[model samples]
Target: MRDLFMQAVAYTSMWLAQREVFAYRDEALQNWTLPGGVEEVQATVLAKLRVALDYARSSNAYYAGVFASVGFDPLTMRGLEEISVLPIMTKDDIRRHRSDFEACESMNSHRVEGKTGGSTGQPLKFSMSRDDYLRSVGIGLAGWHFCGYVLGDRVGVLGGASIAKQDAVPWHISRSDLALNRRQFSAAVMDDNRIAQYWDYIARWEPAYLRGYPFALAELCRHRPKGCAGHYRPRAVLTTSEMLTESDRHIIEKALGAPVFDGWGLNDGGASAYECREHIGMHVDTTRAYVETVDDAGRPVWDMPGRIVVTSLTNKAFPFVRYDTGDMGVLAWRGCKCGRSGLMLTQILGRCDERLNIGGVRTEACAGSWLTDIDRVRRWRIVQDGPLHITITLDVDAGFDKRASEEAVTLSFVSRCSTVSIAFVYAPLPLPTDGSKWRSVVVLDSARHQTRVVAEKHA
Candidate 1:
């Protein structure tokens, strides 16, 4: 009875909020998997691209000026191949001309704001129309469906996106979350005790899907209670936000007793690719955004590694044409084993950023993210130059607690890699002045003794 009630509430709320997503999701389920749907999908993409170009040229000042500067008109666009003539857009361009990117009519209207938890440590903020937000939600739901998830299904999300830790409670659920059958588990510094608590919740809740960062899920698998495997298994484990490696996948799948499905998407741009059951490669959702790979000179490449570029066809309010994602991967025009046709991001070679590999356990430097909440901590950076040595640089206020902060930072890393040593350095302001994005996590190349100094703008 309780499950039925939650389902009713969830679906009813979704219908009231955005019924169009369901419609699109249904169409996607058919078009993405059908044998002859590739041609139809391609036609739809070209039609949408044409409409998008026209809309942007008239409604967006930025694109209009860009088209004028290039002496290119949207009317002359004959094929998707012709899109290459337009200049590529970069993150720096967005940062410099954010206002001009938005549609002139939506400047004063209400919209949704999106900020990416960038891997390079520089957050990019953008706005989306209410309609586009709803469609994106629908598109994401279709991806979830590929992994055997249904609407209103219970999901245990273990990520830093939303911290749910209370003083006594390891996990928290709000009323809305309960209605939607969702629970958030904090991805912050996890020790045995915390992992045990998280596992306890998962065992009780019996979520149909486990979704979160691969690194956090692997930590949970590493510390799960003995004899816990095969006792409780979610339908599938959906991992995103970080690169999912084979080793991490093996660890998570072994402990959870379920297959791991890797996903990649841009938070700010809404372009996505998800793995189907066949698991050959992630099928790109070309219906929402146009995705392609490019060489260093901004020319398209195939069957080989290059940079990933995207153009959001759905985001009319903030149009992004040929936006460089600063990530490297391969885009193949091959068919998947799942019968889904169109484009597939065959490989994700980027975002395999440096990690702290100590005592045979590798972990991300997301501890620096949690430090932002510490009292008097203005900014922080984590640098790993040796296999067992880590230096944390803190730019803090006068009231900072050096001993307590060190203890907190130490616990975060030592809890994962017990053999590593932690040190601290105080800095007033050490940001680069030559206009370069700074990364919070810096991992030096021990082979050549070269430090990859990642910049972080002092706030």
Candidate 2:
């Protein structure tokens, strides 16, 4: 009964905010459903751009200057395709113009301020309003509902964040205005024994949904306790934070005996895409934002893969217009059979900076197929000793031909990057940084002082 009342209150508050802040969205979606076709989705996005431009021109100084620099008259910019004319904003631009990003007048002095985890090895700080916070939470909960989860359903979060360690120091779980629906288990401690203990606790909780970083979840699956394997059957498992490879997804779903869904977004923005029952690809949130895939030159790419650029329609607090998220993915131009009218993202290829270098050449391609084909095993690194070398480090697993994996991975690296050297080493894999997420590919070959990926950490 209490849960129902809380849910009612939350929904009521969300509805009021949706009407107050996103009135245009309400009117637009009145006749439309959660997922719409391509044309409808594009039209809705244009409508959102119109609304966002009005708010941005009035309140956001950053965008005002951006508009002036780009010589874009937002009023005359007709549709989503016209967005291609605007220059793409990089993370460096945001860092340099941090003050300009904020909607200073709208900021409440008491709101919480937080920094991103730099999971892509580039950290960023962004602000969120109380209402914005609520909206984000609401969208996430709604996505889970699409996958058959309810308001009070037990959920487990396996991600990294600073939480109070319950050792001698007194701690308190503060009851705040924010709706804290799920129990969080920290993945900061990578020790196998401690992780096992936490997994045991998760089983005790018997969560309906398991959600977190793909790497952490993969690690848990690798060392899953015998008795706890099938006992804690979750309704679904959702992977976020890192790219969900086919192998990892299959492993997770098989281990948990539930369908796994991928929810994609950045901490700076609210929910961008969510998988529906159809499970084809993520359906873009056309009501709140516009997404475009652009080539390296910032030109729009249709019918092919490119870097994803997103422009937020509702975030007056921060203008994320034409922001390059540093990730690569293909957005499907065709409509989904699911009868949804939102944009679809077919594939999320790794990050732009996570490319492997061979000898002296730079390449963003990988040779090995998902899990089953283990032959392409090679020692690889974006090594910066003095000059960037595609350092191939090879140690093949048993039963698989190590020599073949080495040859394939090495040859692929050589083909992409001409400056390469083969170094055969039988050593343990490099450990990821403390509290830092690992990318399968690393770009900082610091030995030669080539800093391709540069985003300063906040501390």
Candidate 3:
């Protein structure tokens, strides 16, 4: 039967992915697996960082010049702080001089080009060796296994199709998916008809696991039309690209009849954080990349939110050292009950693009300062429309001070922000829309791949 054939293909794909990840990973960075105690993990990650640094120093012209100018030596580094000696990479850096970042020796080497997907609305493209690409995918597979997946099991993926040939998946579906035992549905387009089609795919594929952007899955679940029977009961649903909020998870589980787990990753950073069976916090893969949270002065801050900077240990092709991810988070070293030795990222607050730059006054961390004081108000969302006009919606009970609440909310938003006509409404919490992921702070005109409308309170 066709079903049996797909399962066979899936098993073959897993076998190949496993073989490719481990085999080719060493071809770039030896000892891809950084298993063992915390110190061992730290040592392994640092060693790989040096390997990538050394390669970049020699084969990457831009880094070489920058290192020479700064007189920063990766091989003879004084401490981890010395890494801050290297210039921080940003999207603007990539945009300004993309080719300079490419490994000088990659002229004839096989490579895979990828783009970063987050709130910035603009995506950056970078290249890594084809083998390194497989290695990252292998790590992803390992994460999936942690959440209850076996090689060759039927799987379904929901992702926005870029619509352009360059954005279109460059790989063969059957050769990869059939061999990998998975299929993909378009998350880019989510009309009712598409939802119906997605349901049909699930009923036919009967996937053991489902995965995709959190927003896409939530939309499908929200707009699930009646009369379609989805017999496919996945053991677990995997969400990535965007943070999964507690409310979003509850709704998804209710609709799909499956427990949900989250995958945390940055496309350009080559790092991943995934939840285990314990489901407490995401176990970050420090082996592939080193993660740090630093205050504005570039000092590490604990128990407080800071800018997330990442250094890719595995990416020698374009050693992204101390890359300012522009996202905010807090990492906890107290550890987790899951017994995973790797470092854990306890919180990822939101992306820089998630901030409401009302007239220029940032209202992310301080928005709650004023909104919570309003009487009978349960929650509030700051929605930014195309013209940057603001709308503050409050969820309140009967018999509340609407006028006072509006004044407080407006005062909170327009603190120093430029002139703006604002709208205030009292209603229930706004549910998410399929067109985009939900955001407590939204720019109706902006979609930064990095924004998280909602996520598990704990993560």
**Models ranked on TM-score:** 2, 3, 1
lDDT score of residue 365 within candidate 3:
32
Best by TM-score: 2
How well is each residue in 326-420 modelled by candidate 2, as lDDT tens digits?
77888876666666555677778778766443344445654334223433222223332333354434333446565665676666655655555
Instruction: Please give the distance, in angstroms, between residue 12's alpha carbon in candidate 3 and its true position after superposition.
Output: 3.0
Single out the weakest 10-residue window by summed lDDT for candidate 2.
163-172
TM-score for every candidate vs. truth? 0.75, 0.79, 0.76
What tens digits encode model 3's per-residue C-alpha lDDT throughout 325-411?
877777755445655655667776777666665443454633444553433444456777633366777676678766665677667
After superposition, candidate 3 runs with Cα above 4 Å error: 1-8, 13-18, 22-36, 103-108, 162-175, 230-232, 357-381, 384-390, 393-422, 425-440, 443-459
lDDT of 2 at 454: 22
Q: Model 2 Cα displacement at 187 (Å)?
A: 0.6
**Whose TM-score is higher: candidate 1's or candidate 3's?**
3
- Model 2 local distance difference test score: 0.61
Global lDDT of each candidate: 0.71, 0.61, 0.65
Candidate number achieving the greatest lDDT relative to the actual structure: 1
For residues 244-323, what per-residue lDDT tens digits would candidate 1 score against the true structure? 65656767887778999988888466688889898777888876788878875778888787778888887766777888
